[model samples]
Target: MSRRDPYIIRRLNFRKVVVVTLISLLLVILILFAFITESDIPFNLQNRIRVHREHPSLILVDLMPAFVFILLYPMHRIMNRAIGEYEDRVKESQMIVDRNTKFARELSEGEDPEPYPEMIESELGKALRMIQLNIKSGRRKEKEQTWIAEGKDIISKILREYHDPGELSYQILQALNGYIQATQGAFYVFDEVEGRLTNTATYAYNRRKYVTQEFRIGQGLVGQCAYEMDFIHRTEIPDDYVTITSGILGDRKPGSILLVPLITNEALQGVLEFAFINPRIPKLTIQYLLELGEIIARTLLNLKLNLRTRELQEESRQLTEVLRRNEQQLQENAREMQSAQQKLESANIQLENKIVEANHAQSRLHLLLEYASEVISIYDESFRLTWISPSVINILGYTVEEMMGGKDMERIGRNDVVRIRKMLEQLKESPGRIEQLEYSFIRKNGERIFLRTYCRNMLEDSSIGGFVLNTTDITESKQVEKEQRLKSRMQSLSENSLDLIMRLSASGMIHYVNPVVEDYTGIAPGSILNRSCGDVAFQKEFAELMGRILSEMNRRPVKKNLQATLPMLMGEYRAERILSVDAIPEFLDGELETILVVGHDITEAKRIEKEIKVQNRKVQDSITYAERIQSSILPEPAHIRKAFPKSFIYY
Candidate 1:
């Protein structure tokens, strides 16, 4: 564009020169004609000119106009050239503006515009390219992070909602397959006892081929992934590699195969297989899968643990049921033997058997209590302890003897005692109802602790005449509650805040956006979530500024404060707002989590500031005007003294 500028400028200069010289010549011609045709001229002017030829002064007078014309021509040319140069500069500046405008438009439209070869070295062009690079890189980062976050959410939901690894593995593979845009997928879990990887699920599987498939470590691609516990990507597919099958398209060869091992803490748990026909998977997606492997593996391990725990709980419940029946039988037999001691001698043998069963039940009950991590104590109506679990030593740092009859065993708060007493009275009246209480306590070792106590009224029962209290240490849970409350408060502050608050990852991925952003950006927080900042429809300058800020933050991790004007759509009107934004880095456990952005709308404040400045200037001008008027109208000291000799000047 600038290459032809010199030619255009030279042509303009030449045209100016021609116009000025032609006008000057025309004026000279007109003067000559006026003089030639003049009737008012003296008849002896020519004769006088000839007669004064000998006079040097007349000759000088005759040549004065020629000398003046010669002197002024160069000045006229110089002025014309200067004006032409100014016009040329205005043209070039306009061109630059037009070029910049075009580049901005292209960038906004998501088109990568190239600068002219000659303009590449210019600062404006370089900055434009840099901004383009920043935005594009931010977009890629956003996409990669979104994929990883979404995959994790899906896998986490599966882990929470399902306990069966069979169903869970399928769900995980299905989500990964869809997310990766793969043609086919499969999942396998490693069985430690069997020393093999067993297929748990397959994408679009046929019912006939639903039978489980197993492979020893180092046998196949899936086995290799499990054996090495690393990713396996192959662009070349073997003819015999026919794991992907379909009823409509049977035995279709894949273009590529990607196997990822699910590992947690350096331990292999499973392998994931994905097949792509065109081998167009993004490297970012592969990297995401690698990072997500740990979470998946951990979830699988948790699921297996949960299954084992449920089995153990079932067995425990069965044992408890047996213990209850045996205790009831033992009580019945003892009553029978007491009533018919003389008549029934066979009752002794039955009583012995029942006692033996009762002892076994008692021993099992004690074992259960030991593993239950709870303390069971009996308290009489007067709150006197009768019996306490032997587990109190471990749970409360106090032995059963110390807690059963010890003074100053607990120090309930003054305010909590009333509520607790009220609950106890209700239990006494109900005779069978259970009441739960939570309170802070001072242990025997003088350590402050928290307890959750559940008490049931059993005074009406012949076997048990006191209240049964089941107590558990809940100090750790209380700490969790405190942290949860703090988190809730922070979320509440963000939700109710007037300022726009958003969280962005270090790479410019939007993690969260407050609803207030919608008011200024005309974009809903929902639409902006999990998206790139560059992809948002922000005002031109603001979009570029956001990209620049992200780039700077990545380069140098520091808090950034920037001001921007954003366009907003109000009800039936459009408006622009000036916002002051604070971009602060948020870290968790020494790792960068997100960038916290708080944007405060300062448009109204800025407007009022401008108005105040204008008002102050006006007031200052009024004061200056008054001072000027006073100075002009003031009387001299001498005049005042003359008017009143007795009066003296205040100064």
Candidate 2:
């Protein structure tokens, strides 16, 4: 139910009070009248009341109960005030409750609820706000701690990941800069010998001030930070300083600068300078940097030490190598003398072994070349055959001695000599260029043999005087290629022919089909391959025609030409086509193996013939009718001759 207005409720409560008070007054008055006039009055009191009826005290005392009604007005006023005050207290309590509820709801919804009433008398509100502030503060502290930990983890990883001093400094500085959201940063490694700092790496430095950046101790902020081994943070930056940028364009002036010294074991390793766009860097990032400075310094120092140690070890190895080389030279000299003596004694023995080994190698080589199908030959710059394998006789029907002194053009086919010369010239232009030429060579028996020569030009080489040729007889391959060409041409013509062609086995199962069958029969060639042409799905007319033709062939080689009208499915209708098909049978050893059927579409031709016949019949009937009319209209041959001596009737 909806709440009633406070004034209305107050009025209703006041009316109830007034009614009860008046009713009580009326009851008292009635009771007073009954007691005063009835038996409750004593005889003496009744006589006194009659005698002093005019006296005020006697009348007042006798009608005191009736007089109680006088207090009703004041009582009404009192009860009205009391109820109004009660309503006010209730309204205040409800408003306070609502306010508290709204405050808690807003807090739960992650709203600031800043303008809400925080009455001083309300202790709960104060306590709740306190709790919220405390939780927010704690969360912020936790987040900062996490952020710092993350930064520290990043730096620690960078330190452990790289060993080179330059890379280590660069990666750590870059990480620190990004973790702090700095606009630009630079890292400088200190040179201990020169007591100076050298800028090693930079992160997004827009303008480099020097080609080789170097600063002596106490020269500038970078050097001072290294010399003093302390961190410096500057918030009031000069206006003339470089503008800050993050992604593409310059945004604004940087508001702060930070220089951190890298110190470990009382030795300066490097210095890091970072610039941030914000006036104040986050304490978490600052703390992270301060804590990581020593780690980075230690890593850099370790890398430098390791590099120095590696250099020292390399130098030592070089010294050792020098000494060992000296010792090896002396030993080599001594061994050379001893080997010279030994070689002098074993010279004849080695010569005999070499002769025997050469003879064995020659036998092996000759045996390989004798049976090898391919011939390996060497030619000079003039294209003269210097060396030819023994297999040349078997391959080209020529003895090795007969081919050795001949020029290449003398044996090559006359028609291909020009092509061979061009190929040879190309081969000679570039040494070590391998090329192949297929040319026919004239054999000793006056037969032309094709050779696929794989030649490599080595014209200027001392070992092989001219080209190294590997020739393989390809005469059989050439004949097979020619036959393949013929077969391919025939296949091309058959497939592209206008007539639909199909080859079937003796039992009428399809063996092969050309693509044109799809246009004539509305059937895909591949789908009908190896399938019977007498399937029920085909048009009944075609099936009957092929069936009759095949049946007749089984009995005897009857009519080979078939004329049939097949209805083609055209969308929602059927189009009848007249196909004149011819059956050709192929026999192997006088037995039918397969039959080839050729279908020629003649739908247009049949339509034109039928139209012409109809037109001719109409013309002949009209001509006979005209002749009859002309004879009927003629008066006589005598009348026409009288009108004109040479009158003639044209029909």
Cα displacement (Å) at residue 415, model 2: 99
Cα RMSD (Å) between model 2 and the true structure? 34.0
lDDT of each: 0.73, 0.72
lDDT of each residue in 1-651, candidate 2, tens digit only: 125665676677667766766676677556546655674555464555564564446456545444554555567677768876877888787887788788788878877665356444688778777867876898789988898788878888887788776676667766766668777788888888656688777775544322246765544567546644667676756454343211111345567888888888767888877877778876666667777788788878888888899999999999788667777688776776798799887987977887786577568657767777688888778766788889888888778877765634687756677876677789989976678888778887788888898787867655466888878989998878755643453375467888877766678887677888777666777688768876525557767877876787776754398888877878999788889988877665466756778889999999999999999999999999998897799877788879998777664
Q: How far is 310's C-alpha from truth in model 1 (Å)? A: 2.7
lDDT tens per residue, model 1, 1-651: 365665676667666656666676666555544544563544355845544564446455455556656766676667667766877877877777678779978999988787666455567877887888898899888977887888778877877887778887777767776777776777888887556788888775322125467876655567656754657777756565655221111477777778888888666788888777776667787888888888888988887788789989998998688677777688776775586676576767877877786577568657755655678888778767888878877777777667765632455666566766677778888975668898877776778788898888878654557787878889999878855643553476648789988777778888677788777766788899878997888767667767877887777768989998877767889778899989888765465656777889899999999999999999999999998897789887789889999998663
Best prediction by TM-score: 2
TM-score of 2: 0.41
Model 1 reaches what TM-score against the true structure? 0.40
